[model samples]
Target: MAPAGPDHGGSGTPEPDTGTQRRLARRLVALQSAHEFAEEIVLWPAVLRHCPAGDALVTTALEQERQLKRTLEELAHISPGSQEFTQCVNTLAGLNRTHLTYEENQVWPRLQDGLTARDTVRLARQWSGARRRAPTRPHPRLAARPVVLGTVGLAVAVVDRTRDGLTAR
Candidate 1:
């Protein structure tokens, strides 16, 4: 669970090769982007509809996500072997930890109180499906338009997965 909290002192390579660092960075970007998109498509809407302060909560979370996506986009362009890439990774990790903390603390509690148990379960399934099919690449520009995101997600995801290949797995 996102609200489980952050791993402040996580493990890392003291000196990873360019290939290893690049792969790790891409994997992180892919997973995080997919996770955020899932939230955008399913979780955020539920929050907006059910939670009392859903609007405010969603706004904050989305801002955090926007920052993360921009960082991920920058990371995608940097040379994997350079010092800048390592710094970008660190920056991205820090931002992610902060975002997770917000979700875990403020967002999750509201959600738990706002929705029924059955709703949560159903939302979970939807969120999982969204994650499975969401774009693997960061689309920072789309973060501001929740309506379009909900509608065009499938199309954007198809294009992203096509770029990823016939099958992302």
Candidate 2:
């Protein structure tokens, strides 16, 4: 993810503050979590039901997401001013970029192959709803299961949004 700040004149200079890094990290986690959670709840099931190679594809994506989630949680403990924190963030950016590209290039096609225009539209709506209701922080345990993802995710989203409102985040 692009670190939050002014777009320096393509000089490749990073924002020189921990606060910005922290905010960027949190934002990335929230976005990635929402996207992954939506896939887990909506697209993956459809993939398995329709695509011949769905199991393998979804498994790889799941592993990537699991690793990314773990790394994201670890980021919360790192001092963003440190070199290690920068390295970790860079790693996450690369991983997230790769995952997104793969989803678009591979998983999306498979998911869309059998879907009608109306079905696609419906799925899009559901996906957006899922993202909106998804938690803004890592919850690996709750995220592991579908039942918990639906019920607990809703609860956590409420709490998270409330906290965000109070914190002005």
Candidate 3:
């Protein structure tokens, strides 16, 4: 999670690519989106099935994720000198921090209770694999399912990687 303070260089502002701030923002968003996508695909189902109450929590979390994506998109378009951009960056950082802590506190324990040691390891591997192929940018319009994500993700990953290469990101 990003530190919830002044932009320690990852604000996704319209800064020059030569600087580390823009690159750091991209990397942070990429990793965050990848992990969240993995959890949505691999973890939520088991949680919903084994722990009935988890459905609501997962749903809320997913909505928050969508909002986060929208905020990111806004950030991408925002000028570096704009106050709105600064606020958006701070907001994104706070949301990420809160979501992660909430997941660790409320969701992790329930998932642990539902999954066995072997299941945990298996799911961990699956999660890792998903993250490897997941898109760096958010696709809020896409419904995040295993089949849809696995199929569309490949194409998106290709495009993202291509863009990353061109931009030297």
Candidate 4:
């Protein structure tokens, strides 16, 4: 059967060369990077300074970003139709959902309370700058599912080490 048109279901007729899967993957990477940059550089600092018990949440979110970076790296090379690609996408979706929930429910409120509009705008601009300078190519290690998972594990280990250092003092 032919693919359904937009009028038949959602928006419009899908284009054959719209590169939907590639676009989605690129968007996911952009969003993840933006969120990580916002939390690490802007939101976390404000939360740590203004919100009570913000440090733990910031630390947890940072670790989550670190892990996600590794996962993305691993999944970077897999084509969308492959079994490994499907599994990697599923894993990324679950992790992203969880992270979004935590940020929306727990972190956002704290940031809203602490950060002014001006502060947010300034931070957003900084994030945009960082993203512009970020590498465009996918990490080489992400050529297969096993590598992706292994990279995520390594990132988690690094996060753990960082967390330990933070907690040590």
Candidate 5:
């Protein structure tokens, strides 16, 4: 299924219950929470013990998360058809891209150097437990690609319908 994003235009017709949207939202939240847990509970401690660079990386990631959360909250208020919603979605996507790049390029490698296999497993367990206890609302858009794509698909469908109405005039 297409990932959700602001760019997803809606159909002029009633919105169909695309299980994709809800699933994407849920997964996005789960992924973000898991990533955060891994860093805070597992990676940071290991990095502090072994890799000094981990400190800077974790700090940067946390700041980004804070900003992303704000943007997501704003986007949630604006309906998919609104310009504000699109802008927020775009911002979110950009943030996600940058964050993922940073993690994949710098943070993950540093974490590997700092953490042993046993540490990783222990951290993973902690993350799982945290996720189970985390609240359901306000799922963070952790990664931009999947969520944005899905949202964009829906947004585009909406836009197309609007355009069709104008053209039909």
Candidate 6:
């Protein structure tokens, strides 16, 4: 059920026409949306400040994220019980794998190298805070910045979470 990102962990196999599969899909979407929003708001900003050539690295990462969101949008439209849904899930997993590889290999090391232990710890705290307040749904149209995120992002997040609550009920 986990989507690959800071909060990402183990994977799940799709079960046809099962309640578990539906819940898994929903959970994956929510977790990934939150994780990426946090990274864009906090982690990527640190990357821009710390890493040499940070702009290029963040650009590449965002492109990858944009693709992932697009695919997720596709996945949302498919029937979870169908073969197409399984294929979409696999496709998403592949995209997430590539994204994780890039972040783990490139972006993370640079960010770590740039920060002292204390600053790194501070950034982690900020990122965790952002993650907790992040939107539960993907809003691919918005720009990722602390200022914009501090206002419109939080507002949209509240709305999204409210909708998520309604949907869950």
Clashing pairs in 3: none
**How accurate locally, in lDDT, is each candidate?**
0.85, 0.79, 0.75, 0.62, 0.56, 0.85
Q: Compared with the true structure, what per-residue lDDT tens digits does model 1 show for residues 35-114?
A: 98998889989999889979999999899989999999999889997889879989998998999999999999988898
TM-score of each: 0.85, 0.82, 0.81, 0.60, 0.58, 0.87
Give the backbone clash total of model 3: 0
Top candidate, metric TM-score: 6
TM-score of 4: 0.60
Candidate 3 Cα misplacement greater than 4 A, ranges? 1-18
Q: How would you encode candidate 4's per-residue C-alpha lDDT over 56-108 as one tens digit per residue?
A: 88877767766776777666666765668768889888888888898899988
The deviation in Å at residue 77 for candidate 2 is 2.6
lDDT for predicted candidate 4 compared with the true structure = 0.62
**Clash totals, every prediction:** 1, 0, 0, 3, 22, 0
Put down candidate 2 lDDT per residue, 1-169, tens digits, no spaces: 6654458445566567878878887787778777778777777777777778988988888888887877787786788788889888888888888888988998888878878899889888888888888777766666555677788777887887788789887
Worst 10 residues of 5 by lDDT: 137-146
State how far residue 139 of model 6 sits from its true place (Å).
Answer: 1.2
Candidate 6's TM-score reads: 0.87
| Deviation from native of the Cα of residue 166 in model 2, angstroms | 3.3
